[model samples]
Target chain A: MVNTVDPSGPKPRRALSARNIMLYGTLMVVSMYYLLPLYVMVVTSLKGMPEIRLGNVFSPPLEITTAAWTKAWSEACTGINCDGLSRGFWNSVQILIPSVILSIGVASVNGYALSHWKFKGSETFFTILIIGAFIPYQTMLYPIVILLREIGLMGSLWGLVLVHTVFGMPILTLLFRNYFASIPEELFKAARVDGARFWGIYFQIMLPMALPIFVVAIILQVTGIWNDFLFGVIYTKPETYPMTVQLNNIVNSVQGIKEYNVNMAATLLTGLVPLVIYFASGKLFVRGIAAGAVKG
Target chain B: MTSQSTAKRPVQLLRNLSAKIASIPMILTALVVFVGGTAWTVVHSFTSSRLLPKLNFVGFDQYERLWSTRRWLISIENLAIYGICSLILTLLIGFTLAALLDRKIRFEGAFRTIFLYPFALSFVVTGLAWQWILNPDFGVQGVVRGMGWESFAFDPLNNSEIVIFGILIAGIWQGSGLIMCIMLAGLRGIDEDIWKAARVDGIGTVKTYVRIIIPMMRPVFITALVLIASGIIKIYDLVVAQTNGGPGISSEVPAKYVIEYMFRAQNLGQGFAASTMMLVSVIVILVPWAYLEFGGRKRG
Candidate 1:
């Protein structure tokens, strides 16, 4: 398959090499492996129930319909309400914006302090937060619920936001701290010599320098907060459910004949935000990961 | 100089006060949120609470009962398997992809983006997609059979023993991107002289990767393992989204079990008891490693 000899001419023929053939073959298979689910999702989403019943999942249905898409968006019964996941879409956005901004803002501040100031017990603070990131949220769930209930915010959007912020602190702090640590310490020292206040140093000196990493933090926090399900489900009341909760209800209903088509569409719709982020800032994330934000 | 000194006085005072007060909020947050919540859970676990958290102390009975529950026992076992398998698979695949991409390949960004995109999508979505892809009659099975390869099959989701592996496969897809990014970063950070030295010594690429490159990336490996380990412990979304603990509760994990007992089963005590066990186990495994890594004195 590789290095086929030329018959007429003195020149060597650049035949299809074995490595090329193997690479192309493997890449095609792997790409298909990645694409299979999306392909099936698209297929099912476009097909009517009659086509779905025909059991040709890989084939385009002879009679295709956008009915499933419309139904999933507007009329599919997710719970007691027949209205689809679109009902909670705004609630998701509201929760996401505040949670992402607060968590990132606080974390960047914490990172600046921990990395630059090196105050007493700052290391301890970082350690506890890192460890907290490992504890299963279920372990903290009962207590958080109790605390929120006692404070009368148990089933409120504010409760959910607070919970997200608290949980987000550990990873975000760790990320920012690690990043800020790698930056030249002279920047902070210079700002200090100029009599920059702590806030002044952070705002005037560190903030401008941290623009790229801040973008990374924004991407991470947005994707995470947007896709979150447990906090949204457990903390927020039904009226303020996120789209994940709605998708969960629709697809994960215990008593129904599960509709694959609607489930796929709903899940895709729920993930659209994170997927957009992935496509948009994916390279930045790669480079950001290289930043060694949590190597310790 | 006098004017400067006078200006510095208020600034110095504020700095001192700020540092003094800096920890106050963090400690308060940790106390009220982490410590207070943990204590509350511990107390509730000892109580005979149900649905709305009744506060009558029952003492170790819930823990005793949780220990005896087959599902709880299975969850612990499942987590161990899932954790180890997911970590290994993610590390292996991620390292390979990272290494491949680091070869200065053409269109490197495209390949890296392809691999990393999966991490952005939530488990709820990826799980659903995987569910359809693995559906015995309608998915990969159907596609292969339609191509006249009727002997092909991937029914792990339906089989209990294999279901964990199924979950592991899906997890690797979603998580390996993170590992890849970490490993790639670590690889790229290597000193250029090492590669030059290897080349001068006439070392092949395979030998170089195994002997030289792998050892140097230990920090990133450590970071990747930590991230993956945490993910393994808290892996509820994917299993719930994909399998729903189905094939007769065969794929049940601790988190899901805790959620079920807490909410649907209306047994908050049992849920907290299971949670306490998970916490203890995590600390047992992680605390020592953490101390060695974070607290121990550095080697020469």
Candidate 2:
């Protein structure tokens, strides 16, 4: 793919000086500002109640212990059970894997059809999906619950998976469609001229070039489906709840005194996978954004 | 010639047929699941459903009740304040971060990653983490008091009036990373000549950002506004995690209200009613926005 520079001249680089020093200094401080809460959470989680009592939140704990993590993983009481969030780990996996796969697959098809085939009402479909993206998931919650009940899938993992896929499809489709539109029309024409069927052209030609975007779609779907709470809580049966639901229960359950350490531990544990994926895929995700897939 | 042409005709026909057939499943799934699901929600809201959805018509009584309820009223009012504050803070912070990073700073990738990674985590965790940090007894207050500032009281979770601001802080942290990316994209899209021209005109950096650059970022602003505004309306998990509508229903939002009534409270009628109102509001805002957004593209 070609990197298109602006037809205009480049801006001359500004030299660094005392003013620059102050600007960069301020920016670094702001970056620290952004990172403060996470730092506080980590340090506090490492401390016992005694050290936490001493305040001085920025300081490393005089004594560190994994006790909070241990409690959060296995001993934290959610309701009547102290099973922690381990029970829901498998449930999140069940929802996350299949939902991402199905949603991405459908999005790939939607993108290809909208971009290449340009069928009647295709633009209308794309427009509707775009609009649908802005409708908060809350607006659809009640009806979705009732619909699931009618289909006998409400309170089931299947219901949750379907809901995730429905919501995931619109943005996923938009991402790929916009990216695919940037690919040369000549490539598609050549494939068609070479007697390639529609699916053949997509599979043999377009799919390989789509790997970068596929990585992005995967990251998005995984993070989104894994982090989802409202849908998981509302649609899936309790046994099938994701880690987010478990974390919510452990953290927000109203019956007793809150355990800040255990709550932070569980929250961090639940978020670990996405955070890992995010750091690992930061390069690709950034490149994907620079591809302008989402820019108007 | 006859054989070749006849073969091509069938192949072409098959290609067209399969394309049409393929779209059927995708289109139908979207229609039956999403559109149909949304329609069912609106219709169910009007009916008197409880725990389980029943088809008994209750007219607009649920809607009437929703308006009169203090909880519903408070939820909307709180959401407005939360949404506006969050939108402004995230935009300002996000734009600053993006602009700063664009200045060819040290470890640009690392800094960007540090800033952007927060967005990848679920709000459930982010909310909980913030909850712990902001809790009066155990969090910042504890630390501050231990440092001998005995009067320090950073406990928004316990106070009703100030709790909403506490919630907005967390939302901004989670959302700003995304806005940063969008703004960065817009910044990178700017024509180099604009910057050169500004420099030639002896424009100060601050003046350039305010006058020349910010105005050019209209698309980015619109994108950010649309995305952020929508998310704010459905903002449930963060508030729940941070405050759980604490201090006696002080922080309740529409989404949480709907959820509570749906299952916990078993007032599904009101749940559906609240949802219906939300959906109507969404449509009301979205229809015009969608038209302006899409209409300009194909026509303009």
Candidate 3:
């Protein structure tokens, strides 16, 4: 099997050798496993209710229709609102924008300071922050609820935004800290020697130089906050529920007639934002998650 | 030293005032939230807080009740099952996929994107999609049955005994790609000479991977293991979306248990205890990883 196709050649491997067949065979089957669900979703979302009732989930639609998509977008009932997933879409967008901005804003600055400015006990605080990332969010949920209630921001989008900022701080700060620390210290010193203050060096020198890391941070936060369910459910009201929460309610609610097509459409719509970000950004998305995973 | 200390002590707080000011959020979060909040919860767990968090000092009764409760027991059992299976399977599948791609295969990028696109979607989407695909009437069971095997029985979601595996299927689909990507990075980090050396020694690919590549990739495996383990303990949304602890609480997870008690059950004490358990579990997962990862460097 090792050299059946190319025994006399310099390289013994062949394109269609038994080994290649097994390798590509396993990958092909696994890829089918990955691709099958998405295909079922698209096909289901296109078929009508009557057609889907035929009980063939894997089959393509007899005739494609966008009714389910529109209804999912504008008319589906999710917790008595019947306003479809648009409200959640907007809610997620509102939550996503502010959460991303505030979290990244605080985190980038925090990262820059931790890496460059060695204040007294800074390492102590930084160490605490890193450990903070490991603490289960369940343990801290009520305390944050109390804190938000104290601040009069409980059950509001801003409270959720603040939660995202706090939670995202650890990973984002680590990402930027490592990235900024890699930059030659001479650049920071030169900027300092040129009569630059903290904000000056940060805004003028660091921000522009850290564009790639910023993109990485954005890719990380966008999918994370967008796909978030627990926080959105915990922190926001039904009216202000993010897409994931609304999506769950819309699909899992026990009170309504189950619309499989609409549910598929709703799930697809809920997934589109992050999916677009994932595909469009490609390798950067991998870098973002890897950074989040292999903590420094 | 005393004179220098005295000279700089007065201006110490003022030094890097701007940087300190910039760090206010991190400080407050680290101190007031992470440390303070966790401590507050731990304290509250000792009290019999119901409806609202009041300091009643119940002396472990909440924990006693929690351990005895069937729901919490099932939740923990499910988490353990899910965690262990997920850890091993994720590593195996992730490494296999990584190795296949590392074989200089054609369309690696396309294959990876196909495999990982699910990770970008929310757990709700993954769950619902799998839920539909696992539907008894229209899903795999049905499709296979229609193919002429009338006695086929693959319905796991509605079955109490195998419900957790149903959720496990969805969880793996949504997660293993991350481990694959990480493993691929580790694989690429290996020197080309290692592969060349193995080839010159007339070693087979499987032997090289088993005896050589895997042992050398301990750090990467540990990273993946730690990531998967911690995530398994936090499993909530996927369960909620997929099973919602359905078929009579068979698929409940600890995270879901924590949320239900705190918010819906209005049993704050139980919630605190359960969440504290989650924290302990996370620490249990992290401590060893930390020791393996940084113990030598930190201590020696």
Whose lDDT is higher: candidate 1's or candidate 3's?
3
In candidate 2 the C-alpha lDDT for residue A42 amounts to 80
Worst 10 residues of 1 chain B by lDDT: B1-10
Candidate 3 lDDT, tens digit per residue, A1-296? 46523233256446888878998999999999999989999999999999999859999899999999999999999766988999999999999999999999999999999888867777788888889988989999999999999999999999999999999999998888888888898999898788787889999999999999999999999999999999999999999999999999999989968999999999999999999999999999999989988541
Per-residue lDDT of model 1, residues A12-37, tens digit only = 53346564566546554665655666
lDDT of 3 by residue, B78-193 (tens): 98899889989999999999999998888999999998999898898999999999999899999999999999999989999999999999999999999999999999999988
On DockQ, the leading prediction is 3
Residue pairs with backbone atoms closer than 3 Å in model 2 (clashes): A55-B143, A143-B41
TM-score of each: 0.87, 0.90, 0.96
Q: Which is superior by DockQ, 1 or 2?
A: 2
Residue A232 lDDT, candidate 2, scale 0-100: 88
Q: How high is the DockQ of candidate 1?
A: 0.38
Clashing pairs in 1: none
- RMSD over all Cα atoms, model 2: 5.0
- Candidate 2's C-alpha runs over 4 A off are A1-16, A53-57, A255-257, A287-296, B1-9, B51-58, B296-300
What DockQ class does candidate 2 belong to?
acceptable
TM-score of chain B of each: 0.88, 0.91, 0.95
Q: Can you write out model 2's per-residue Cα lDDT over B17-61, one digit (the tens) per residue?
A: 766676664576466656776677778888888778898998998
State in Å the error of residue B70, model 1: 1.0
